[model samples]
Target: MFLDILLYIFIGIIVLQFIYYIGIFSVFSFKKAEKKNPNHVPVSVIVCAKNEAENVTRLIPELLNQNYPDFEIILIDDASSDETLEIFEEFEKQHSKIRLVKVENNEAFWGNKKYALTLGIKTAKKPYLLFTDADCFIPSNQWIAEMTAHFTEKKTIVLGYGKYKKIKGSLLNKLIRYETLLTAIQYFSWAKKGKPYMGVGRNLAYNQSEFYKVNGFIDHMSIRSGDDDLFINQAATKNNTEICYSLESFTISEPKTTFNSWYRQKRRHVSTASHYKFFDKAQLALFYACNISFFILAIVLLVTQHQWILVTALIAFRYLFTWISVGCGAGKLHEKDVVYWYPFLEVTLIFTQFSVFIHNKFSKPVHWK
Candidate 1:
């Protein structure tokens, strides 16, 4: 009787978890950008580069050609040994809107990228600040307009999606893209519900004043990373944050080519999880616990007793519902192809991410870009 009761309890938890994934996560379906004047606000787009001459030559021009008026592009050269400085200087000569801040890396400097970003933000000329990476490609010229359109008087922080470019015929590529989509659904859904916890630096914006008000990474100076999400985690509130889901607002960047490279990248990202607020950490923990438990419970029940039919039915219901919800989200994010890999990748990520989380705690600390 005790075993039977335990099985039912586990089954009940699984059902609730499935409901949350579908019912709560499906909030993305209703996500729409609130109408506002895209051109009204003057934005300073900041890109901090170390040694990305090739990418700068190819992608920076595209950013300069953006359709928005009354905006400046602040490119920070963080002591590059390559041709990055030359490229920035050339662009500066060609366009007056482009401002280059050259930094010579010194051993005496206190922080890493956070220090560099602080310098960039300090030099920004506009009230509103937008940030992206050197490798990021803006899909449309209206990227600024779409991202800024969501900003209002109360909404100081604007969160936008940054996706990895699709690589053909690669399983790793598919999993990477699906993993990004899954992470997006969680962050985006929470933001829509007014519990904005984080934002990606690759495509994010906020008011320059608010950043200084929070002291701008002063709290996390000793720790590396968090230049993006950690700052957002600290500054964002229910009333002060908004999200942008329009395809026009999206930014795409190159994905790491090897498994080791990708793993290190994800490790660096997960390292910031330890510094998140207690509530945010708890929220993420519950989701991961339920995900891991679902699989473990299913296997134990199958082994202890022969309830194959019932177990199969339960699994089928959970899987089908989750697929529908994820499929809708994928379509909304312009990641329609990710839905096909959802079933396999979802289960794989449950284990893979657990391993990464554990390894991150004990492994050598990851540094800033």
Candidate 2:
């Protein structure tokens, strides 16, 4: 009877998560009607480069060529040990609006990226700021214009989608794509509902004043990451946060080739998850717990041969829920191909995330590129 009660409770939690996913899908579908303006607020595009000489040389040009009326590109060379600064200097010599800043020394208690961004933000001439990594390529010339359109609606922070460029004949490529799609769905859904908890730094924008208002990375200076999501979480109010899903505003980055590299990157990201607010933490914990619970329930049912009907029903409902929710999100992000890999992705995600949770709890600090 106790096991039955626990099973029912787990089933109920899964059902609730399923309902939450469906509700998000409905909201996203309804939000599809909102159109963006071509002429919007001016923006300052910020890129932080660390040992990315090749990326700075190749991708920085595309950012400078964005079809926006008024904008500046500020590149912060975060003590890079490569030709990253040299590349930026070459670009600066050619482009008038492109400025370069170098952080040679660690100032007391600031993380590398956050310190660089703080310098960039202070140097920015515009009120609006759009941030993307040096390794990412803007998909369209109108990227800045499309992204800035959201600010006209009084939004202080706008989170845009960052996807991986498609690479064939690689499992790591598919896994990275799947991870990107999954994150886009959750973050975009939450943003659309005016309940955003985090934003990816790779392609995100916010007001210059808002960053200062929240004291800007002062809270998480010791932690390596959170330059993007944590800042957004602190500054994002219901009236001031918006999400952009337009293809013109999208940015693409290269994927990690090896499993070890990917795992380390994800672990670094997950390390910051604990620093979020109570409600945000609860929501994420609940989501992960549901996934873990469903997996365990499946195993228990197979072993005990008990509550078979309830287990089957819950499993069916869970799959259907994930399909629609993740599918709708993928559709909005222009990643419909991810739907085909959802089943495999789901299983891997549950296992990997659990491992990440355990590893993060016990592992020492590790750096990544």
Q: Model 1, 1-369: lDDT tens per residue?
A: 865765786778777777667667877744553556675599999999988999989778888888997799999988888999999999999999999898877675533887888888989999999999999998799999988887788888999999999999887888889988988888888887777888999999999977988899999887778888899889999898988878888999999888888888888888888899898998899888888888888788788774767877887888888888788888888888978878788888888899898897788656754
Question: Root-mean-square deviation of each candidate, in angstroms?
Answer: 1.7, 1.8
- On the 0 to 100 scale, the lDDT of residue 36 in model 1 is 60
Model 2 CA lDDT for position 28:
72
Best by lDDT: 1
lDDT of 2: 0.82
lDDT of each: 0.85, 0.82
User: TM-scores, in order shown?
Assistant: 0.95, 0.95
Itemize residue pairs with steric clashes in candidate 1. none
lDDT of 2 at 103: 82
Instruction: Please report how far candidate 2 places residue 5 from its true position, in Å.
Output: 2.3
Span of 10 residues, lowest total lDDT, candidate 1: 29-38
